[model samples]
Target: MNREMLIKLWQAHKNDEWPHVETGQEGPLMTLDTVISGCVVYVLDGEEDLDEQRRAIVSDCLAELDTLEIEINDECRSYFGRLREIGTLLLITT
Candidate 1:
């Protein structure tokens, strides 16, 4: 995904403003799954290329989530899987 779009999505998720899900539950404010899925949508909608910096940001965000001990819900896991499939297709075609 374009680094700028990815960063923007990441920032949105970090701020708990992702449009897909409403905020206000308990526990961690954000999760890796949500951030990654948001990034995927941003990437796909923008038709942006996934470069090293974008990948690094994704990796770092995921790592940070892991360190935070946040658990991925089933819905988020499903979203991640779908994003992975779509991302794979985009990679193969581009």
Candidate 2:
């Protein structure tokens, strides 16, 4: 996904303006779950451009997403799963 799109989605979630569940996702909770999980991965990628402190923050964010219920599409699940593996590896290193 585009970096800007991820940022926008993340911002919307933080603002409580969740995506329209009926637009494509399973439902309200799943929408937020998938968005958040994806955002964590985005932030994980961004950490490479950030300083140690910022990277720590990103890793912390990833830490919180470990038990999230990502109820998105199969493609998204596969995509996010790959990112999650990379992100999880980075988290452990941090």
Candidate 3:
């Protein structure tokens, strides 16, 4: 796992300065939280499905990292976007 980015996010979260945004069930019908978890974690899901609550936390955490200007590579970003798209589809589909 890309511990570097994850560490940055974890640090930002610990410092209470990540994403600088609030996460809740209330907001956009589809939120980052509503989707899957952190991109890295998502990619490394290893066939294990994550609980919604955990996924939400991870999603917002990633968003926080993005806001903090912590760069995630293109591959990860692409995978992230794909995961988001898949989530959006699922939301719309079901």
Give the per-residue lDDT digits (tens) of candidate 2, residues 1-94: 4445444544444455333333434453354355445545556566443446645655655554443435454444543444455444434443
lDDT by residue for model 1 (13-87), tens: 445533333243223324545555665766667867567765665666555545432344554544444334433
Candidate 1: list runs displaced more than 4 Å.
1-35, 70-94
Instruction: List model 3 lDDT by residue over 31-91, tens digit each.
Output: 4533343433443345334456655655564555355323444434544344444443322
lDDT of 1 at 18: 30
Stronger candidate by TM-score (1 vs 2): 1
Q: In candidate 2, which residue ranges exceed 4 Å CA deviation?
A: 1-52, 63-69
Q: For model 1, what is the C-alpha lDDT against the true structure?
A: 0.48
The residue pairs found clashing in candidate 1 are 1-50
Query: Once superposed on the true structure, which residue ranges of model 3 sit more than 4 Å away at CA?
Result: 1-70
lDDT of each: 0.48, 0.47, 0.41
Better of 1 and 3 by lDDT: 1
Quantify how close model 3 is to the true structure by its C-alpha RMSD in Å: 11.2
lDDT of 3: 0.41
